[model samples]
Target chain A: MISIRNLTKRFDGNTVWENVNLEIQKGETVVIIGGSGGGKSTLLRCINRLVEPDSGEVVIDGVNILSPGTDINAVRRKMGMVYQHFNLFSHLSVLENIILAPMKVAGRSREDAVAEAKQLLARVGMAGRENTNPADLSGGQKQRVASARTLAMHPEIILFDEPTSALDPTMVDEVESVIRSLSEDGITGVIVTHDLQFARRIATRVVFLADKGICEEGTPEQLFDHPTKLQTQRFLYRSRMFEQDLSPETLDLYALASELRAFLRRYEHERKQEKLLPVLCDELLYPVLKHPEAPAAGASLRLLCSETSSRHTMMIGFRGIDSDPLEEPYLDELNLALLNNYAEFVLSRKKDDGWEVCIQM
Target chain B: MTIQKTLQGSALTVAPEGRLDTITSPQLESELRADMNSVTDLVFDLANLTYISSAGLRVLLSAQKAMNKKGTMVLRNVKPEIMEIFEITGFSSILTIE
Candidate 1:
């Protein structure tokens, strides 16, 4: 168990946060999420005394580790940290990197440390990669090894600082699964990240850190779906969004569909929504291109997919178009039927030079 | 898109592999045009077809109309993702699937 009382931090004259308080139970995974430079990572570091707070009581198991006479190294032995860049020793093999801390810091025998290292590697899905160099592995692989190295210390808590920040989109799931398994094993975790979707998946309790202090804190569903604060709502809405430019002559519907599928997959959308996304592109977007008066290029598309709401909304704005594509005389029967069936609502409005259509599904 | 055609005694089987979209549908339309008069029975194997767009559907609709005059056209082994597209556009009712 850990508790923080009256925490404060400042960099030169700029105050990061003040009077911050939080509590962590034995097995709870608490995720601290917010925009960049909000002291989320600094708060995590202050817990381990990696970044000393200007004033605070970081009491871990009845010991105030932030106090003057406290043994910082001994306190840190119980807390493991996995960094964004996966700070593994480049010259050491995977096994050696993991075993070094256990043998040197914990005073375990080489055979004992090595055996435990192999088991930790297996737990993180890197079982057969014991002799591989850190430089030889992928970003995801290196992070898993960094995690295994941390686990070798047998710490009661693990602190992750943007664990998936450097990973390829395809490799994020592998690292996320490892972190999820650790929570299942009843290790208290404090993760600071910009990734809201990952926080939604991993957090037992969510904390929103912004504007120099705690903005809100609640369960993932309560915070993501029904945040009471206006700041939290705006952050959630703006985080899961994308924009693109469409060229009618060169647009590849299949490629666009795949791109949309990947974006939805990142947020862990429902199967029904996934199936309908491509249909939305084909029936709704394709009709605009097929319209006789449609422009050759310069169509702007913006999509905002909200985890808080059931609807996924898209706005398509076209320049140099005289007529609205959704008008009665332009839209064909089959395409209209598909549009009515797939979308919740469709509206078209006029602009100075062109027009825009907003569809919600 | 790659189309593999097998013609045995006027019954032609045309199998398209990969996506049938705006870019590739015209190629399929021209291929069918070149061989239309010599064929009586048409079979389309869609087992390898990954996707289809409205342009592809228009080509299929015209083929079905042309086949109605003197022959029959049938599609087989449609993947579920592609079949949903057909069902959405009401092509499932117009095209014969086996």
Candidate 2:
């Protein structure tokens, strides 16, 4: 169980979020959802003291995380974080990565760590691949191995920051499948992700983070379909766009904006690779082009305008299909993230073989 | 649905409060219809009623129609709040209310 009151985080005087109050009950899975810079990751970091919050106390079970007498590392040992980059020691084998943390920190013996690592590898569906090097494994396999590695720590709760963002399309389901199983087993977790379906399926409770605080907390069925905040609606829409094609040559400004959002989501689930969605839709672009007073496409003014209000200006005509979206047979605990943050998105059927999405306001 | 019965000679008044949902409506219906023959006048006190979703509405309608064929049926203390909802949904015309 975790209780946070009046939590605040700032970066060089820029406040990321403040007055954040949350209480997560024991054996509960709380999924955090929000847009970039909404403080999803910063909140997680503050909890683990990875980033010292400006103020507040985080009490886990009974002890305050910031207590003078609290043994931070010892308390952290009960919590494990999985990174998107698959933070495996490149020189270490899959089996070695799993055993390393437990051996060094938990003081697990070599023989005991090895035995536990093998079992973890099997649990994550990488039983025979334990001996494989990080480079030899596929992206999804690497993440699975990373998960097994984290599991080796034997923490009471695991925190994931976009665990499936690095995997290929086909590989994502595998990672999600694994996570779903872990959640079914009731392994308490606080995941920061753009994956709506993951929260719907695996989370016992969902908290929408935005506007310098928690926008709302309730059952997924209530928040996803019946969210009360304008920010939550926007975040959910952006998350669904990740699967669509964003032409590679989109403007740098748009790319930068995309990275900013990805950073926030990653801070929660720990994904390393970030994506940039295609810039300004045609309907949105026409207004910029026909600006009777503006210059050409490459004009600085045109670029500046696009970066400022592109999300609000553009409208995608289609809602693409999500085949096997939630029935993630592959990636366990993986939820679909808003891969693209650009507002002017089109659900191009030509790309994903023509998928129609169910739309809800 | 929770039911409270008050008997004045053969004239019986029953107030079923709270929700009359799919899971609870049947209990009230059974209790009422099971002893229908012993009643001459019937009155339903709906003052405490707050919600009448479709399932609840259906039961109330049926009971009213059944009572119409048996004896006098009047809905007493029909709160304005419930009355407005019934009127909006065009259910007020179907029931005898005071």
Candidate that would win on TM-score:
1
Q: Which CAPRI tier for candidate 1?
A: incorrect
- Cα-based lDDT at residue B76, candidate 1: 97
Error of 1 at A339 (Å): 31
Per-residue lDDT over A157-176 for candidate 2, one digit per residue giving the tens place of the 0 to 100 score: 78888675555435668877
DockQ for all candidate structures vs. native: 0.22, 0.00
User: What TM-score would every model get versus the actual structure?
Assistant: 0.57, 0.54
Q: List the residue pairs that clash in candidate 1.
A: none
Error of 2 at A273 (Å): 17
- List, residue by residue over A113-208, the lDDT tens digit for candidate 1: 989998999999999999999999998999999999999998999999989877654477999999999989999999988778789998999999
Best by lDDT: 1
Best by DockQ: 1
What fraction of the reference structure's interface contacts does model 1 contain? Answer: 0.37
